[model samples]
Target chain A: MSFAHFSELLEHIRARRSPRRLAVVAADDPHALEAVLDAVRDGVVEPILIGDAAAIAILLRRLGERPDRFRIEDVADPTAAARRAVALVHVGEVDLLMKGRLETATLMHVVVDRSSRLRTARVMSHLAVLEIPTYHKLLAITDVALNLAPDVEQKHQITLNAVEALAAMGVVRPKVAVMAAAEELNPKHLDSLDAAELKRRSLAGDLPGCLVEGPISYDLAIDREAVTLKRYASPVAGDADLLVVPGLTAGNLLVKALMFSAGAKFAGLVLGAKVPVVMTSRSSTALDKQMSIVLAAAATRELVHG
Target chain B: MSFAHFSELLEHIRARRSPRRLAVVAADDPHALEAVLDAVRDGVVEPILIGDAAAIAILLRRLGERPDRFRIEDVADPTAAARRAVALVHVGEVDLLMKGRLETATLMHVVVDRSSRLRTARVMSHLAVLEIPTYHKLLAITDVALNLAPDVEQKHQITLNAVEALAAMGVVRPKVAVMAAAEELNPKHLDSLDAAELKRRSLAGDLPGCLVEGPISYDLAIDREAVTLKRYASPVAGDADLLVVPGLTAGNLLVKALMFSAGAKFAGLVLGAKVPVVMTSRSSTALDKQMSIVLAAAATRELVHG
Candidate 1:
């Protein structure tokens, strides 16, 4: 019941009994609208577009779509549009929230605001699912975009956020590799020490629904050939479903290297909120955006049901 | 005058008027001997093999080489071999050092010992040169295997060490990218702050022989398309000769990713000593080890002549 590719996630969302509602803040972006239209045509999600109505309509026309075919709300300013989108999620009108052509900080600022009902006690973290050509299945990495220099406690929350997201994708009991420079515990390496603590917590059943091992290196974590060559033994050695990085920098560099250099396609979303938030980079491909929406819809089912 | 590939580095070393003498500490490993023999056949280096004479002879014969063809010194233990290797360099008997069948910490311990004359006032750093298929030229990363969690002062030394190594490879003024998670200067990210300070110091003429740009992400640092897409302005944006990573973890993960996933070929050496030290990984390919020897030989010229 695990997703081997992003297209599988799309198929899972489409198989749902009804389409989930998605609130895309600042939806005037042509690239974002194109992804939305593809999802709409596939019946992945019902869109509630919140942005400049005139721009969205003109862009829709450019795509040869009727302006009145979908729901569009006009909010001129970016901040106001984000607030309106957050409000939609607060009242249970929208199952998911998305950021389109808007500053991620702008949307995140309102999503985490204390006054906003969307704010939960859980810490918000970003989860990215990558389809690497060399890997056997989809790989998930957490806090690549959010939570800079997260502490041990924050890392615990981030690990749980990614674990839950993976579970929602039908990956039961995912194997998580808490990565570091080396496998040994060195006092000078903060990441290694943090990884040891996280592994301890997971072993104690504190972080449930995942098998955690660390401080493992990247080669030992993913490459079976390396595991055999190095004689390193672990259940998660060559089959890690999730990689919980030490900080934002390592995760950011790892994912970008995978995409630009290693030929990987990825979809990312903000987890631990009341609803899954799709806040992809503007430089992301249209297929990436479409996959993010699909992933959000699938994760939303887990949030609403549980 | 610049090396765009590892084969070019090999040719540069082969073209040297005199082959640099390299002291191979604990040289009994078959893989290490295979690489050393390749370098010897190409007249890149004259190796002083220091290890168990019986084992070295057997390995040489296994490779179809005559035992009397090269100099072989018998040392039973790893620590003693490392000390003997350092003493050879201290007395100017050897121009470079190479590690074989010995722990890097053991060799580095003797290299940095105060009593060892090979020790200098400069900080020791590990520099790795990767010939990434997607990159334009040879990419150098600093402190990948050494200097864990270096402070601002130590980072300055590491940067200078890498710059000097590049200069030895005939890059007169190398472009160095001080990589971080993002380009913006955020207070929460310590690496970004350190990158900013390093950039400021480099501009103020503190770090000469290199143009330093910092607080940059991986995408903007190495990818020209990403640099143009984001419009990040810097002379080193897409054409970095050296990348000074924040710590050993980030650099280690990055190079390992490029090798395992991106099909990159790499060579590495330990810089900031009296002699260039080749301490490649045991799992490294024969070509990687050969390139390391070539790089060490090319870099030894600068150390000896400067």
Candidate 2:
């Protein structure tokens, strides 16, 4: 039941019985309000706006929407909004949390605080689901925005978080490609060694419900022609559902190249928390923000809440 | 005189009065021969094919070309062919070297050997000249194939190599972006630290003939909208001529994404040597291979030989 496109994910979410409750921290943000309005109009999410109530109302009115129709909390301070959103997650009031025009660090600190109740045993990581025009289906890339230089163990946890999140989204047995420079285990390259070790762990069933293959190059992972040409034998080759980049720099560069150069549409979410978090960048398009909200709503159904 | 596209580069080389002599190691490769034939027909290059003369002749005949029309050195073994190619470069017989049907390690070993006399004071690095549809002009990415995790000094050399090569090809004062996950100096991320150091060096005139900016992310480097959206201040921000990656993994991922997902046409060459070396990947299209030859030839005329 994997999604081939964002439209499919949107449709899948809309078909659900009821809209999920979403907490929009710093909800005074116009861009966030626009996306939330679209999601609400689509019957995908019921938003609990937590920010400067007066500002939110004004912005909502400016957009030709009635602010009185939605619930609004007057937490004017950005940190307070973030704290309130996390508090909602603690009391089973919100199924997901979203950052809105606030400093990401301000929201992230509250979300990952020891007392934030949104903390899960697994380390939180960012997952970006991209709709590349050239690809056959939706591809999920991980930790592009979060982990700086994740080691083997951190990457292991990151992989599990993505695999579980994708599974929750109806992707059965996601094929994961632990990306490296090339598809060979070179002693000189720690990335290749890390990839090989992850593969070994996958084989040991440490990373269950996923087929992990690596030290795979980008060409071998996505291009079947390259698989056939290089004669690289792996199930994950040419049909990767997930790409776990070696570090943040690689993943960030890859995603930007896809967006700016490849003309890809993407939706990003922060996983490994008690609830999924939507933190789209300011540069993200309206479509990207809408798709992210839809994706968050879709992934929210089976995930654990307070 | 910077090239806007690979066609412009081809035109630039074809406009030259005399064609540069190119030595193709293990020249029996069909793809290599096809590209060479195209370059020859375009009057851009005079190829000195060094490989098993029998196989080279057979391949030439198979491709509907005459073997007798071109000079073929009958070096039977791949290592011997690589050695002979390096020897030609030593005595100034050829202005450029192109790898054909041989292990890259074999050719690279010969080219980098102290006795081979191809080594320069600077570390040899691989540069990919990409003609992306979305970009305004050709973008050069460095060290995607050669250096693994280059230190700041090595990266300095790598950047110098790319800047010099682009300058030779008529790109004046190339704008270089030292890529990172974000455009901030973070103590935790060595990539960011390295980028800042490089920028500092560039400011001190250590990296002459280029505008080096860094601790910059991909979106800011290539997308003007992102630059405005983020309010990132840099001249190189929306119009980078070169991208120097933190390491091989990041660069390789970036280049592959541009190639496979972005539908970019690219040609690769090894720089910092006495002469530019064409070493296109097996998966490169014919245009890419031919463009590599053209690029090598254009770069060769201004580079040191003998």
Candidate 3:
């Protein structure tokens, strides 16, 4: 079922008649433990914490979390913990993977390992879903933390991934804004050229599931006044839900700018993988981490179990 | 001459005794003409309209304007009208140039011509000043519209250009946030690498007149909580007045996102030219144009004619 507010997703996870099992890799870090503990208490997820059992137990007790109520997977080595998390997902033991204290590259390496069950034909990329108080709809930015330098084909999949995720979250047909310097192809600016090409692909049915318009500047995409005053004509001009940036640099800067300047609330996840992955930034608050888990659970429910 | 509030600049422009000379090229476009007329009525400027005189007369009459009240330079050709606008600025006849019905590149070509007085040793770039109600201080974004692909040296110049303009508007030392994808130098992302180098250059006085920090992602640069929580150290972190982007695409999207999603009011001008220039998009409202005129007048009064 499509969801309107993130709270609706929280409701679904809470009921979890068939709970979405989330495996935490190297779940020894205090912050990571705190987040999962909160999730478990909320009853939105069934946890399979994979790491040093003793350390996790001590940290959980410090936070007043009881161990008898939760599932613990003790793996001494951090790498082994990562391997076990992926192994759980591969064998259909878990529905999602949450990175804990381990480094991202290490966890990602194991998740994408050809021998792992989480491997998929499509490349993995990060997607950030933002909730700005000023915007009427949620703002979706892709490949901000992952897929550093994606080419045209990778970008194509990235767009599809975000659209599907949003569609699964209740957006019937997300208006995709292909961001660029100008709404025309300029050789000196490769992004604009790429934006134009992407629009063509979307229109030609190469990229299904959404409406895409590109080679368009930022203002024309989201501001109805800008579109009307500037005489800009595009169906996706004022009501865009997903913004497909030209590259990681633009996506990263765009998402962070809104959060920092406008006090926007956000949740991020890795998509196009075999399973939904939760990977919040280190700077994210406890609240932010909670929101991300909620987001991942909702996305997983919509995509895999729906 | 520096201003802390946008209203302060507006009041100063409203008080100017000698109205600044404004040359309007191809003065037949409805939106462009409306903005120019509004500026004239506000006494912020005195315009010399150049285009098809008959068409302009009709447009003015339709707007209930006194057709013969202002100077009308009849040029049947739009390209020639654009050239005249630049020529007037070159010859000290006008303080700023505005594009009326013509294309932006046409006016830029004449301004950049070596033979024109509008050409200067310093490179020209675009500067957008935002008066967002939610924030305490005005936010300035540079190199958003022009400079498709700027290198490190060009970015340094962009920083200096923004600082000078903001200083003219009353910021003593504009805290400049050099934005990139990540908060640290990752060898793979060139923007972050360049940001690190730019910061070093600022310390060495190469990018003089501003506090520069980069490889600093958007959130770390503007969000105080994110800064304190993440422990990212830099004066620019929570107190940036200006944001210098790595390229046009990132910068353009940022300004748009803020305006559309955050309800920001903005005014922009072309900097590093011989004179302050108003380069509003053809679709801009009269208020946007009037605000741009006020900004240009104040910057001109302080930077060029002080």
Candidate 4:
């Protein structure tokens, strides 16, 4: 029952009893192919690769894998490939969605179309599970890649989005630390006010599903020594389960820095959608793509796709 | 002369023929005292430690140091101690200023008092020189520890503040990349627009003291390979001397993550308040504090403090 590694989470997914299918939108990307291949090898989920058939075959060969062994939907147009993948999920052909070599917006656009069954009233957010070598546990940074400038209400929804996902990942009663410039509100700081408001909402159950506390700095959120020095008390202090950034820029910069400077391994996916979507960056490594698949698969099973 | 190691910077501060006297405002923190003592031992500065006499004596004794060897001013009241430190700088008792055992706002309040003679039209900001092991050279992150929610005009001031500080430290015509989530303006993302505006202002001579370019992400800002993939064209893309973040939270999180997770050696100082205020966080290592002192001393001779 103790999940020290994501591999353990994968084992949970495999013994999950009901097998889940993942629809890969624009699967022509070599990196994407490698990841799905890795997932297939690990038996995480079954894949329905949707893209140009000839291109997928060429990529599979280059990756030293057989072409005809898997289901390949032949859609030439990239946008059409994305729509087809979304349709697969809608028609119950797949239980999960993924962004492949094609544009993220293209796939996301199709996924969020109100006419499509994938539309969810919840605000979409990005959840990045980062394993920094120095940290004792994984740090979950939210809304970093999605929801550019979330207002107080949007952040409320974003918090709910992350808390639930984190809970589903077995983070019981996740300690949410809303990161701001300082640990106290200075009236002039809108972010601090927003954080304080979110904390109030969490207490009042308006932003339910987590132990939310804020107007806290990253130092207080992660470092127990700083907490002792500052004399700040919060469940998230020195042991944050999820970090709720005020805006996208802060989230993006922090995650990118971890990846670039700290050798932090990242697995991020889009939440608050009808189904969890793997929105890996175009330049993401094969490992990143593979990890995103594992994450998306796990998150989707805990969402509407469940 | 090129400054490679911190020791070289330390030696440069020592060998600079005319070392500027630094006024330490309310020096009492253990970390702060240890740092000032180290700087004094290195002979890079002539320090004027002003604080409560009893506390200072106890602090020095704790550090295996004797308090009476240098000029020590006894101002028991913490508030008055800040005032005395400012007055010392005003009356030419010291050329540079350092903060110890006081909140930044309390010290900054006196430093920018209209009657204090430390205030100017230029806005004050914090600059950090991060010596990350992964990085090939020293990285400057601006407005990281100060200036929350900076607008376009305030950001201009922040940029100017960093440029001036870096220029004083001998980075003539430093490459300044205004970092954002992405390279292009996505109308929804304000940091991108702010970066583009900053670049435009630099092009129009409204912003001087550095080669400014932006709407750039962290990868392209430091890593050369990212530049090739993103196809971004800027000298600062791969070799930025300074990274101007969008706001305080972004800067704080970026630098904190850089220091804590990435193992970056960092030195922080408050700039633009008539003098370079040597300030280090409690989490800042002793080497970081000493580095800040060396930086402050090396920069004091320039247009910064004197």
TM-score preference between candidates 3 and 4, better one: 4
1 against 2, candidate with superior lDDT: 2
TM-score of chain A for candidate 2?
0.97
User: What residue pairs are clashing in model 3?
Assistant: A183-A215, A230-B283, B2-B169, B2-B170, B3-B169, B3-B170
Q: DockQ each candidate and list the results.
A: 0.77, 0.88, 0.61, 0.71
**Model 2 root mean square deviation, Cα atoms:** 1.6
How do all models score by TM-score?
A: 0.97, 0.97, 0.90, 0.93
Docking class of 4: medium
**lDDT: the better of candidates 3 and 4:** 4
lDDT of 3 at A11: 74
Q: Each candidate's lDDT (Cα)?
A: 0.87, 0.90, 0.79, 0.81
True contacts kept of 4: 0.79
lDDT (Cα, tens digit) per residue for candidate 2, span A60-116: 999999889999999999998999888888788999899997998999999888988
lDDT digits (tens) for residues A78-152 of candidate 3: 789988888777677887789888888888888777777576778787878877776665677787778876888
DockQ of 4: 0.71
Q: Which stretches of candidate 1 lie over 4 Å from their true place?
A: A302-306, B302-306
Chain B TM (all candidates):
0.96, 0.96, 0.90, 0.92
Q: Highest DockQ among the candidates is held by which one?
A: 2
Model 1: per-residue Cα lDDT over B1-306, one tens digit each = 567788887777677657889899999989999999998889988899999999999999999999998999999698899899888876778988999998888988888888887867888889999998888788998888888788988899999988887787678899899989889998888899999999999899999999999989888888999899998999989888888888888888888888888888989999888888999887898999988888888776633542
Give per-residue CA lDDT, model 4, range A199-286, as digits (tens).
9888988876688888988878887877887788777798887899988899999988998889888899989876788888877877
Residue pairs that clash (backbone atoms under 3 angstroms), model 4:
none
User: Pairs clashing in candidate 1?
Assistant: none
